[model samples]
Target: MGTKRLKKQWLLHAVGGLLMTGLGLSLFGEALIKKWENAPLWDWLLWGTLALLVFNAGVSLVGQAVVFRVKLDGRNEK
Candidate 1:
Protein backbone atom coordinates (compact mmCIF):
# COMPACT_ATOMS: atom_id res chain seq x y z
CA MET A 1 0.00 0.00 0.00
CA GLY A 2 1.11 3.61 -0.62
CA THR A 3 1.43 6.24 2.08
CA LYS A 4 -1.20 8.95 2.24
CA ARG A 5 -0.20 12.60 2.30
CA LEU A 6 -2.40 15.62 2.84
CA LYS A 7 -1.89 19.37 2.87
CA LYS A 8 -3.33 22.02 5.17
CA GLN A 9 -5.04 23.91 2.35
CA TRP A 10 -6.86 20.77 1.34
CA LEU A 11 -8.25 20.54 4.85
CA LEU A 12 -9.85 23.94 4.42
CA HIS A 13 -11.40 22.86 1.15
CA ALA A 14 -12.78 19.71 2.76
CA VAL A 15 -14.21 21.54 5.74
CA GLY A 16 -15.70 24.30 3.61
CA GLY A 17 -17.20 21.69 1.32
CA LEU A 18 -18.82 19.93 4.27
CA LEU A 19 -20.29 23.19 5.53
CA MET A 20 -21.54 24.10 2.07
CA THR A 21 -23.06 20.65 1.65
CA GLY A 22 -24.92 20.99 4.96
CA LEU A 23 -26.13 24.48 4.11
CA GLY A 24 -27.30 23.37 0.68
CA LEU A 25 -29.21 20.47 2.18
CA SER A 26 -30.83 22.74 4.71
CA LEU A 27 -31.83 25.17 2.00
CA PHE A 28 -33.22 22.36 -0.11
CA GLY A 29 -35.27 21.03 2.80
CA GLU A 30 -36.60 24.49 3.52
CA ALA A 31 -37.57 24.89 -0.09
CA LEU A 32 -39.40 21.57 0.00
CA ILE A 33 -41.19 22.53 3.17
CA LYS A 34 -42.30 25.74 1.53
CA LYS A 35 -44.51 23.65 -0.75
CA TRP A 36 -46.87 22.86 2.13
CA GLU A 37 -46.97 26.56 2.90
CA ASN A 38 -48.01 27.40 -0.67
CA ALA A 39 -44.89 29.32 -1.57
CA PRO A 40 -44.78 31.01 -4.97
CA LEU A 41 -43.34 29.09 -7.90
CA TRP A 42 -40.63 31.71 -8.39
CA ASP A 43 -39.50 31.31 -4.80
CA TRP A 44 -39.25 27.55 -5.16
CA LEU A 45 -37.36 27.81 -8.40
CA LEU A 46 -34.88 30.34 -6.99
CA TRP A 47 -34.13 28.47 -3.78
CA GLY A 48 -34.04 25.07 -5.45
CA THR A 49 -31.59 26.17 -8.10
CA LEU A 50 -29.41 27.95 -5.55
CA ALA A 51 -29.39 24.89 -3.32
CA LEU A 52 -28.38 22.62 -6.18
CA LEU A 53 -25.60 24.96 -7.28
CA VAL A 54 -24.19 25.19 -3.79
CA PHE A 55 -24.41 21.44 -3.32
CA ASN A 56 -22.67 20.83 -6.62
CA ALA A 57 -19.94 23.36 -5.80
CA GLY A 58 -19.37 21.63 -2.49
CA VAL A 59 -19.13 18.27 -4.19
CA SER A 60 -16.68 19.73 -6.69
CA LEU A 61 -14.52 21.09 -3.92
CA VAL A 62 -14.50 17.74 -2.19
CA GLY A 63 -13.56 16.06 -5.45
CA GLN A 64 -10.68 18.51 -5.90
CA ALA A 65 -9.41 17.64 -2.45
CA VAL A 66 -9.41 13.98 -3.34
CA VAL A 67 -7.65 14.58 -6.67
CA PHE A 68 -4.62 16.45 -5.31
CA ARG A 69 -1.18 15.52 -6.62
CA VAL A 70 1.26 13.36 -4.60
CA LYS A 71 4.67 11.85 -5.07
CA LEU A 72 5.29 8.11 -4.87
CA ASP A 73 8.18 6.34 -3.08
CA GLY A 74 11.75 6.32 -4.48
CA ARG A 75 13.48 9.37 -6.04
CA ASN A 76 13.14 11.69 -3.06
CA GLU A 77 14.52 9.10 -0.64
CA LYS A 78 18.09 9.54 0.64
Candidate 2:
Protein backbone atom coordinates (compact mmCIF):
# COMPACT_ATOMS: atom_id res chain seq x y z
CA MET A 1 0.00 0.00 0.00
CA GLY A 2 2.26 2.74 1.25
CA THR A 3 5.20 1.00 -0.35
CA LYS A 4 3.52 1.13 -3.72
CA ARG A 5 2.70 4.78 -3.28
CA LEU A 6 6.28 5.55 -2.36
CA LYS A 7 7.54 3.65 -5.38
CA LYS A 8 5.31 5.65 -7.67
CA GLN A 9 6.35 8.90 -6.03
CA TRP A 10 9.98 8.00 -6.44
CA LEU A 11 9.55 7.24 -10.11
CA LEU A 12 7.73 10.49 -10.77
CA HIS A 13 10.23 12.53 -8.81
CA ALA A 14 13.25 11.04 -10.55
CA VAL A 15 11.66 11.35 -13.97
CA GLY A 16 10.63 14.91 -13.28
CA GLY A 17 14.15 15.86 -12.29
CA LEU A 18 15.68 14.26 -15.36
CA LEU A 19 13.16 15.93 -17.61
CA MET A 20 13.73 19.39 -16.14
CA THR A 21 17.49 19.23 -16.44
CA GLY A 22 17.38 17.63 -19.86
CA LEU A 23 14.87 20.11 -21.20
CA GLY A 24 16.87 23.10 -19.99
CA LEU A 25 20.10 21.74 -21.39
CA SER A 26 18.44 20.86 -24.68
CA LEU A 27 16.92 24.29 -25.04
CA PHE A 28 20.19 25.99 -24.28
CA GLY A 29 22.05 23.94 -26.89
CA GLU A 30 24.95 25.68 -28.60
CA ALA A 31 23.79 29.09 -27.42
CA LEU A 32 24.08 28.06 -23.79
CA ILE A 33 27.59 29.46 -23.46
CA LYS A 34 26.42 32.90 -24.55
CA LYS A 35 23.81 33.02 -21.80
CA TRP A 36 26.42 34.03 -19.23
CA GLU A 37 27.16 37.28 -21.06
CA ASN A 38 23.87 38.19 -22.74
CA ALA A 39 21.33 37.03 -20.13
CA PRO A 40 22.58 36.32 -16.68
CA LEU A 41 19.05 36.19 -15.34
CA TRP A 42 18.08 33.36 -17.67
CA ASP A 43 21.26 31.51 -16.78
CA TRP A 44 20.57 31.78 -13.09
CA LEU A 45 16.97 30.76 -13.58
CA LEU A 46 17.92 27.61 -15.44
CA TRP A 47 20.56 26.65 -12.88
CA GLY A 48 18.17 27.26 -10.00
CA THR A 49 15.49 25.15 -11.65
CA LEU A 50 17.91 22.28 -12.21
CA ALA A 51 19.17 22.48 -8.64
CA LEU A 52 15.67 22.35 -7.22
CA LEU A 53 14.76 19.38 -9.35
CA VAL A 54 17.89 17.50 -8.30
CA PHE A 55 17.29 18.23 -4.63
CA ASN A 56 13.68 17.06 -4.84
CA ALA A 57 14.72 13.90 -6.62
CA GLY A 58 17.32 13.13 -3.97
CA VAL A 59 14.87 13.67 -1.13
CA SER A 60 12.26 11.50 -2.81
CA LEU A 61 14.74 8.71 -3.34
CA VAL A 62 15.78 8.73 0.29
CA GLY A 63 12.18 8.84 1.47
CA GLN A 64 11.17 5.97 -0.77
CA ALA A 65 14.09 3.88 0.38
CA VAL A 66 13.27 4.42 4.03
CA VAL A 67 9.62 3.58 3.51
CA PHE A 68 10.50 0.45 1.63
CA ARG A 69 13.00 -0.66 4.24
CA VAL A 70 10.51 -0.22 7.04
CA LYS A 71 7.83 -2.16 5.24
CA LEU A 72 10.18 -4.99 4.44
CA ASP A 73 11.47 -5.18 7.97
CA GLY A 74 7.99 -5.22 9.40
CA ARG A 75 7.00 -8.34 7.56
CA ASN A 76 6.48 -11.59 9.52
CA GLU A 77 9.77 -12.98 10.64
CA LYS A 78 8.53 -16.56 10.99
Candidate 3:
Protein backbone atom coordinates (compact mmCIF):
# COMPACT_ATOMS: atom_id res chain seq x y z
CA MET A 1 0.00 0.00 0.00
CA GLY A 2 1.01 3.61 -0.51
CA THR A 3 2.36 5.86 2.24
CA LYS A 4 -0.50 8.29 1.79
CA ARG A 5 -3.01 5.48 2.17
CA LEU A 6 -1.32 4.28 5.30
CA LYS A 7 -1.39 7.79 6.73
CA LYS A 8 -5.09 8.06 6.06
CA GLN A 9 -5.76 4.74 7.72
CA TRP A 10 -3.66 5.80 10.68
CA LEU A 11 -5.61 9.03 11.01
CA LEU A 12 -8.88 7.14 10.82
CA HIS A 13 -7.78 4.76 13.48
CA ALA A 14 -6.72 7.59 15.77
CA VAL A 15 -9.94 9.51 15.34
CA GLY A 16 -12.09 6.42 15.75
CA GLY A 17 -10.27 5.50 18.89
CA LEU A 18 -10.70 8.93 20.43
CA LEU A 19 -14.40 8.98 19.67
CA MET A 20 -14.93 5.49 21.03
CA THR A 21 -13.08 6.31 24.23
CA GLY A 22 -15.07 9.48 24.77
CA LEU A 23 -18.37 7.79 24.11
CA GLY A 24 -17.49 4.91 26.36
CA LEU A 25 -16.45 7.23 29.18
CA SER A 26 -19.70 9.15 28.87
CA LEU A 27 -21.73 5.99 29.00
CA PHE A 28 -19.73 4.71 31.93
CA GLY A 29 -20.38 7.92 33.82
CA GLU A 30 -24.06 7.70 33.17
CA ALA A 31 -24.10 4.12 34.37
CA LEU A 32 -22.31 5.09 37.55
CA ILE A 33 -24.68 7.95 38.24
CA LYS A 34 -27.56 5.53 38.00
CA LYS A 35 -26.47 4.07 41.32
CA TRP A 36 -27.65 7.18 43.12
CA GLU A 37 -31.04 6.79 41.51
CA ASN A 38 -31.46 3.20 42.72
CA ALA A 39 -31.14 1.65 39.29
CA PRO A 40 -31.20 -2.13 38.94
CA LEU A 41 -28.01 -4.03 39.69
CA TRP A 42 -28.02 -5.74 36.32
CA ASP A 43 -28.40 -2.43 34.53
CA TRP A 44 -25.36 -1.05 36.23
CA LEU A 45 -23.32 -4.12 35.50
CA LEU A 46 -24.39 -4.27 31.87
CA TRP A 47 -23.72 -0.69 31.02
CA GLY A 48 -20.50 -0.59 32.97
CA THR A 49 -19.17 -3.69 31.25
CA LEU A 50 -20.19 -2.49 27.82
CA ALA A 51 -18.58 0.87 28.39
CA LEU A 52 -15.34 -0.76 29.51
CA LEU A 53 -15.24 -2.96 26.42
CA VAL A 54 -15.68 0.05 24.21
CA PHE A 55 -12.99 1.92 26.03
CA ASN A 56 -10.61 -0.99 25.70
CA ALA A 57 -11.31 -1.35 22.01
CA GLY A 58 -10.64 2.33 21.49
CA VAL A 59 -7.36 2.13 23.34
CA SER A 60 -6.30 -0.80 21.17
CA LEU A 61 -7.13 1.14 18.02
CA VAL A 62 -5.09 4.10 19.20
CA GLY A 63 -2.23 1.78 19.97
CA GLN A 64 -2.29 0.36 16.43
CA ALA A 65 -2.26 3.89 15.03
CA VAL A 66 0.86 4.65 17.01
CA VAL A 67 2.53 1.55 15.64
CA PHE A 68 1.68 2.57 12.12
CA ARG A 69 3.04 6.02 12.74
CA VAL A 70 6.28 4.64 14.13
CA LYS A 71 6.80 2.36 11.15
CA LEU A 72 6.04 5.18 8.76
CA ASP A 73 8.54 7.42 10.46
CA GLY A 74 11.19 4.73 10.27
CA ARG A 75 10.61 4.35 6.56
CA ASN A 76 10.87 8.09 6.04
CA GLU A 77 14.27 8.12 7.78
CA LYS A 78 15.71 5.59 5.28
Candidate 4:
Protein backbone atom coordinates (compact mmCIF):
# COMPACT_ATOMS: atom_id res chain seq x y z
CA MET A 1 0.00 0.00 0.00
CA GLY A 2 1.07 3.55 -0.57
CA THR A 3 1.91 5.75 2.39
CA LYS A 4 -1.42 7.59 2.16
CA ARG A 5 -3.41 4.38 1.98
CA LEU A 6 -1.42 2.92 4.80
CA LYS A 7 -2.15 5.94 6.93
CA LYS A 8 -5.83 5.68 6.09
CA GLN A 9 -5.80 2.06 7.09
CA TRP A 10 -4.22 2.92 10.38
CA LEU A 11 -6.80 5.58 11.02
CA LEU A 12 -9.60 3.18 10.25
CA HIS A 13 -8.10 0.62 12.53
CA ALA A 14 -7.91 3.16 15.31
CA VAL A 15 -11.49 4.30 14.81
CA GLY A 16 -12.81 0.78 14.75
CA GLY A 17 -10.94 -0.10 17.90
CA LEU A 18 -12.28 2.95 19.67
CA LEU A 19 -15.83 2.15 18.63
CA MET A 20 -15.75 -1.43 19.85
CA THR A 21 -14.10 -0.55 23.11
CA GLY A 22 -16.54 2.20 23.91
CA LEU A 23 -19.47 0.02 23.03
CA GLY A 24 -18.28 -2.85 25.16
CA LEU A 25 -17.67 -0.67 28.19
CA SER A 26 -20.91 1.22 27.93
CA LEU A 27 -22.88 -1.99 27.65
CA PHE A 28 -21.22 -3.55 30.68
CA GLY A 29 -20.68 -0.52 32.88
CA GLU A 30 -23.52 -1.07 35.33
CA ALA A 31 -22.81 -4.74 35.81
CA LEU A 32 -19.18 -4.08 36.51
CA ILE A 33 -19.98 -1.52 39.14
CA LYS A 34 -22.35 -3.88 40.93
CA LYS A 35 -19.70 -6.56 41.24
CA TRP A 36 -17.22 -4.41 43.12
CA GLU A 37 -17.35 -3.01 46.63
CA ASN A 38 -16.53 0.53 47.71
CA ALA A 39 -15.89 1.42 44.14
CA PRO A 40 -16.62 4.95 43.09
CA LEU A 41 -18.83 5.30 40.05
CA TRP A 42 -16.18 7.18 38.13
CA ASP A 43 -13.62 4.55 38.97
CA TRP A 44 -15.81 1.82 37.58
CA LEU A 45 -16.44 3.89 34.50
CA LEU A 46 -12.77 4.52 33.93
CA TRP A 47 -11.80 0.89 34.39
CA GLY A 48 -14.58 -0.34 32.18
CA THR A 49 -13.61 2.11 29.48
CA LEU A 50 -9.99 1.04 29.64
CA ALA A 51 -10.91 -2.61 29.47
CA LEU A 52 -13.10 -1.96 26.47
CA LEU A 53 -10.39 0.06 24.74
CA VAL A 54 -7.86 -2.71 25.26
CA PHE A 55 -10.26 -5.29 23.90
CA ASN A 56 -11.04 -3.14 20.93
CA ALA A 57 -7.38 -2.45 20.18
CA GLY A 58 -6.72 -6.18 19.98
CA VAL A 59 -9.75 -6.82 17.81
CA SER A 60 -8.91 -3.99 15.46
CA LEU A 61 -5.36 -5.19 15.08
CA VAL A 62 -6.68 -8.60 14.12
CA GLY A 63 -9.05 -6.97 11.68
CA GLN A 64 -6.22 -5.03 10.10
CA ALA A 65 -4.21 -8.23 9.74
CA VAL A 66 -7.06 -9.99 8.02
CA VAL A 67 -7.60 -7.11 5.68
CA PHE A 68 -3.96 -7.04 4.67
CA ARG A 69 -3.94 -10.77 4.16
CA VAL A 70 -6.90 -10.59 1.85
CA LYS A 71 -5.33 -7.80 -0.11
CA LEU A 72 -2.13 -9.74 -0.49
CA ASP A 73 -3.98 -12.81 -1.66
CA GLY A 74 -5.85 -10.83 -4.26
CA ARG A 75 -2.64 -9.33 -5.56
CA ASN A 76 -1.06 -12.78 -5.86
CA GLU A 77 -3.99 -13.99 -7.93
CA LYS A 78 -3.41 -11.31 -10.55
- Cα lDDT listed for each candidate: 0.73, 0.57, 0.89, 0.66
Query: How would you encode candidate 1's per-residue C-alpha lDDT over 1-78 as one tens digit per residue?
Result: 233444554566788888888889988998898776889988887888889999988898777666542322232353
Q: 9-42, model 2: which lDDT tens digit per residue?
A: 5566556656655655554452455465576766
lDDT for 58 in candidate 2 is 57
lDDT of 3 at 11: 95
Clashes of each: 0, 0, 0, 0
TM, every model? 0.76, 0.47, 0.92, 0.49
lDDT of 3 by residue, 1-78 (tens): 678987998899999999999989988998898866789999888889999999999999999899888877877889
**Model 2 whole-model lDDT (C-alpha atoms):** 0.57
Clashes of 3: 0
Q: Per-residue lDDT of 16-68 in model 4, one digit per residue for the tens?
A: 76677666666466548654666777776777667766676757775885676
lDDT rank, highest first?
Answer: 3, 1, 4, 2
How high a TM-score does candidate 4 get? 0.49
Compared with the true structure, model 2 gives a TM-score of 0.47
Task: Provide the RMSD of all predictions against the true structure, rounded to 1 decimal.
Answer: 5.1, 5.2, 1.0, 6.6
Residue 25 deviation, candidate 3, in Å? Answer: 0.6
Model 1: lDDT equals 0.73
